[model samples]
Target chain A: MENQAQRSPKRRISKDHWTAIAFLIPSFILILVFVYGFIGWTGYVSLSNYNSLVPDFSFAGLKNYIYLFNDFRFQADLRNTVFFTILFIGLVIVLGMGLAILIDQKLKGESIFRNILLFPMALSFIVTGVVWQWLLNPSTGFNQFLSVFGIQPKWYTDTTILAGFEWGSIEFGLPVAIIAVVIAAVWQMTGFSLAMYLAGLRGIPEELREAARMDGASEFQVYLKVVLPMLMPITMSVVIIMAHISLKIFDLIYAMTGSGANFVTDVPGVYMFETTFRGNYYANGAAIAIIMLLLVAIFIVPYLWSSRKGDK
Target chain B: MAAFPIGKLIKYIILIFFAIIFIMPIYVILVTSLKPLDEVSLATMWTLPSAIDFSSYVEAFSKLAPNFMNSIYLVVPATLLSALLGAMNGYVLSKWKFKGANTIFTIILFGMFIPYQSILIPLIQFLRTIDLYNTIPGLVLVHVVYGLPITTLMFRNFYASIPDSMIESAKIDGASFLGIFRHIIIPLSITGFVVVAIWQFTNIWNEFLFAVTITTSDQQPVMVALQNLSGSQIVQWNVQMAGALLAALPTLLVYIFAGKYFVRGLLAGSVKG
Candidate 1:
């Protein structure tokens, strides 16, 4: 292809070039105002005294942030978010990658299995929450099946903090009830990692695996030593994507189980919604939103930067 | 190769087990929705309904029908507008690249990963200021704006695969910017359009945070109404399950029929980003 610079004189513009800018201007402006501008406004609100229903944008200087750090519910939300993000991302990787490898084996009825795993990805998180709420109900749902084995556990309703120890007016351990939410989340989202890994696996040439086999690597070792290493980038992408989702998760937990007893399942997303909308604590909500954005940015900014650099 | 058979058996066992776990909720939804209230209980949770009951469907449809229409109204135009804007921006970014294009693209892409909470306070306030609050148009605008990042990313990646040689040759032939887009780029990007449209449709249809907060009561979408159904005082498992199915039906149908494009959209959205 001819170089683009070769066709046009240095620093001279064309009508088409101006038209292209015009085409992009609207979306550029919208994103600039809505995303960047809104974030700035929310940040300002977080620092202001805007806790009441009526707008109060007076400067409060980190009062909301300080209060959240010391608040019981917010403390629990932080703990829950940490546990949820770790468990959710871990399970999604293991299950999704495992399922992807199995499906990549050229087995009979492969598409059928793949479809079953992926169909849930199409449904709304709200629907998943509603359906799973019933399916995991402690007294009436999966417990009945578990009862056949003489074991039943209270699912989401359980507020028990496993390995409980006091920290900041809340337990500094995994809330057992969170396991139920994690199960539903993993089920809905594992399909994403599966699809991603499947695409990555397909991109890897068969000759590479053949070469590994020739090196006396067994089938398991071929995957462990040869394949899994090659799929690292895909894993990185999945982790970042799932991390963002797990961090901002609201609809699923809201629909399936509201902040459970003792706020075990309360995430920043849920807390933000209830505080801001339900309770009219706008500044507090904005603080939560800012924190959520920061947590997500920790994963996303570096990922976006490196990916753009990679594109070059 | 003597161990191959056992390995294969174990793979099948594991795959089948997870598959069952994945499909279990659907089975529960179906069985519970079809059962009479008397039979929808802990003891019979896993059992098939004694008689197929359509009353839950009637009730759920009647309750969710209006909000269901609200979602349809919101999704259709939001999907179209976002896809069109994305295509234009993508064409500019990929084919008509100027300096700092990558930086601008990166900035725009950041919007996609943001927790919507960060913008919710201001978004609602802005909507109210503009008199679009609690209206379907308000939701549509929100979806379109937020939807731009992913749609733009998808279309940019899609258009990137189209060789620059084609655009360069077309420009040499005196084809104007819109001319090339109209004559060549648009025609070649039907599949790109499909993937992005289906993605936007599904996302806007299934979105909840914006739906629940922006619109309340009658103006709310199906998902919020469905949540309300379950959250209401007297819990009706049958109706709740039926409502879940009803709310999920459109995207479910889209997945069943055009799932290939949907999956393509999924991979395009995540992998390319």
Candidate 2:
């Protein structure tokens, strides 16, 4: 190949180059149209007055955004999403790391426990939502069973707000109803963070632990000072990934508790879906989507940039 | 490595507790599905059914049967087409390096991160324009298109592990690009195909947003159908649980039999990318 390339570099370059281009062309076109192109179109729709059943592409110019910011449902969505993302990511990290540590103890039936934990990751959020819905039903399901123990709680229907404080056009506090959704989200995603942390735990050399022990560090001290620091990068990845999933969460919330009592579990993704399809508020939905994209971008772009830099 | 007996017991207790927490919902679903409708109350959620009943499965299966078939039709072809496209893209991007190839790869990779909601409005419009709206083929096209980024990333990373000299040698034998991909790349990447296929199959099978939005009732996938089974005013807990299980069975089976590969796919899809 080297000798032939030297003999006729031009012919080889053109033929191979075209072939490479040919192979890439289909994907390129599809991605360009579907991903990039559709995003552009969505951006356009967000700026237009394309509300109602009929398509009206007249210039709206941030009107929809302004309306959504003022709208009560959208405001509640923003608040719910913020609290959900924090609580969901926090719980997933803690539970995931704890489980990783426990499983890393070289216990019996490690694969059984790992597989059981990770199996939830295999099911759709839709299925997870359904099962969780039944389990968390305020009147039936676990409530009935738990009532025997003198414990009765409105699982997802609980709309009590904690740390309640008034903010500009929205209540800035944790909506308690989100806890059920958070539990469901954490259950499904803990496996992902667990897998990551487990791999991170395994990658840390045993010699380091021995070294820590030789320095008179206790087991917990070694974990805190050495192992924890080593797992920082994995934790960052987990946070970003979990944050992204939480920000765009739809299926579980949609299936489990549709908007909850008084929209306590309402999220931007659900609101966007309902507005676009059910209410025929196309432009409003587009605005919600663009906001979601921006939110996801804030988490993802930096990660992608750093990963690209690492690649070089 | 030895701990106090008390500490070891505590560890076992904690592990068992979480294991129960994780498994309880599944257990409830299983037991609930097997109970007769009259006995399917939340109070009996933990009880053994007096008699095993397959009636719920029969009812759920008959209702979900069409949608289940839709998921199969959607998953198989979508997986194959995307994997094929990804292999070709991966081969070229990794082995047949070109000017600005890295830029192109990065651009495509960006597709993986964009929230799908951001594009749905225009995606529906585009589908309607192409006359594939509300059809199985339309959903397939959407899945293939949206699936391209991750699939390409997986295959590219996989093919990168293949030494470039293999391609160079194939070239030396007067093989064209297609010839090399067909013989050298395809044969070498069977495991790659399996990984990508499993990833895509589970994903497409379990995907809800596109399945719900793109196709109406008759064309709906099982995931959407499963959601619908519980949408009525009067809920049948047994049938709903049965439907949920039936819907989840394929992916669950995949995770059970080929869990290692599934985890590999997850790691490859996330950790590397």
Candidate 3:
């Protein structure tokens, strides 16, 4: 009887562990094959000489990467992505933080205002793109409305490089045409940062603010020092999240502007799509994909690292 | 206290100004969508339609009808399957802790941050190899795989809130693993399921990159179809606006009714990650 009791408990525990692992097995296999396995395959393809529609797995060194780095369209895409990221992140933070503060003032019809601001977030970026495409049409849409104020500037069609300079066969300047695309992006994503900032603001204890007030700090001082510093973590989260979205932005740009005049608004994501599917430059596209992955990794890997450490 | 009214007034002015900027595009689209073909012009953009018109909607709906169905067929099964798989994975990771469970989770969660563009080439090649290219099932599989990281994180965090003691007590009763899950976990996770469902539904519905890449003409989801609608020559502003509204209606309704859950899911997904 004693032997049976001990054996039964051990077997039950093993059985439980086995079942638990069994539950994870399906997800494990799928993620392994789909995420990690496919990533490895892409890395290999990036290093190969497979430029056609056919799958030639024969190896070539970093030649494809070199070719892309020297390519004008790719260079333009790099420049556009850099400018877009800077402008998009800058505007989203400003607008989102600004709106959050405005709403936090305990305005009347708070939910109504909040809903209106956030409603855009619900629509797909494609829809946002289509809507904004029409609105920012230089000849029509918002241009006509703005003409009443005498501000009729070419929107997406404008390819003038502001503060233009050249470096290593790439123009290092803001493409004015990308600004229209940026506006649409900022409009769609500002709600996210707004919500995050509002949450972060709400999380601050009233006692902290009251204590600051008792110390004779002005309202601006309180926000500048206490509230903004307190919101740093949320801001980091917002930046990393927005950076990922911006780096891989496709649909909005694709629908809003197709590679723009002079490829001014072209991004790597759209470039990769067209190059691979439209142009059938498969190897070149793979190299672009790898470079994008490396850029995202630079931002996200460290984030995951720090966040994991924080969790511990 | 005496300065309060002026402060409040200034606050209202700022709020109203920003609100107007935020609502302008939506207002333009709404009005433009309602305008008849000839009335849809730059000058009339800010003006309300002279008369309510449904003809643009009629035209857009007929054009977009097939792709709209495609989106439905794609989103429903994809959401359910991903959520179910996430629930299962969450049950194991949280309730049934094992060696390297956290490590395994961190690995899976890392998948969420991948730009996905990185994997497109191989993903396409693999799908073609498997003969699933240009099919809805192929897109569904891609979504489910990519969605695992976020949904797993969601359900795991959710299940963590359910005390481990419940599972311990159930285990002490000689209930098997499946029994404990079927009896205890599933019943308790109805709200978790709802939140995950809403998140996945919105995401998969709004998703364009995968849908655009994975599916071709007939199999294209509504977002891609919407893009195609505008891509053709001689763009009809009224019809296009109406098509945009039609494409947005389902998710817009979800946001309207379940805005609370949507926000909750967003917070949970981002904050936890």
- Number of the top lDDT candidate: 1
Better of 1 and 3 by TM-score: 1
Residues A103-131 of candidate 3: C-alpha lDDT, one tens digit per residue: 98777799988888888888899999999
Residue lDDT tens for model 2, B1-273: 866589777888888888888999899888889998789876667787999999999999999999999999999999999999988898888888776787788888889888899999888888899999899999999999989989999998999899887887778789988888889899999999989999999999999998899999999999999999887767688899999999999999999998888888887788764
lDDT of 2: 0.90
Tens-digit lDDT track of model 3 for B1-273: 456588788888888887898898878778888888878776667788889998899999999999999999999999999999999999999887666788788889888888787888888878999999999999899999999999999999899899877887787799889998899999999999999999999999999988988899999999999999998777687889899999999999999999878877887788863
lDDT of 1 by residue, A1-312 (tens): 347466455756789999998999889999999999999999999999998988999999999999999999999999999999999999999999989999999999999999999999999999999988888888888888888899889889888888879998998998988999999999999988999999999999999999999999998899999899999999998999999999999999999999988898899999999999999999999999999999999999999999889877
Q: Which ranges of candidate 3 are over 4 A from the true structure?
A: A1-13, B1-4
RMSD (Cα, Å) for all candidates, in order, is 1.6, 2.6, 3.4
Which 10-residue window of candidate 3 chain B scores lowest in summed lDDT?
Answer: B1-10
Q: Which one wins on DockQ?
A: 1
Candidate 2: residue A56 lDDT (0-100): 93
Q: Against the hidden true structure, what lDDT does model 3 obtain?
A: 0.88
- DockQ, candidate 2, vs. native dimer: 0.74
Chain A TM-score, each candidate: 0.97, 0.93, 0.94
Question: Order the candidates by lDDT, highest first — what do you get?
Answer: 1, 2, 3
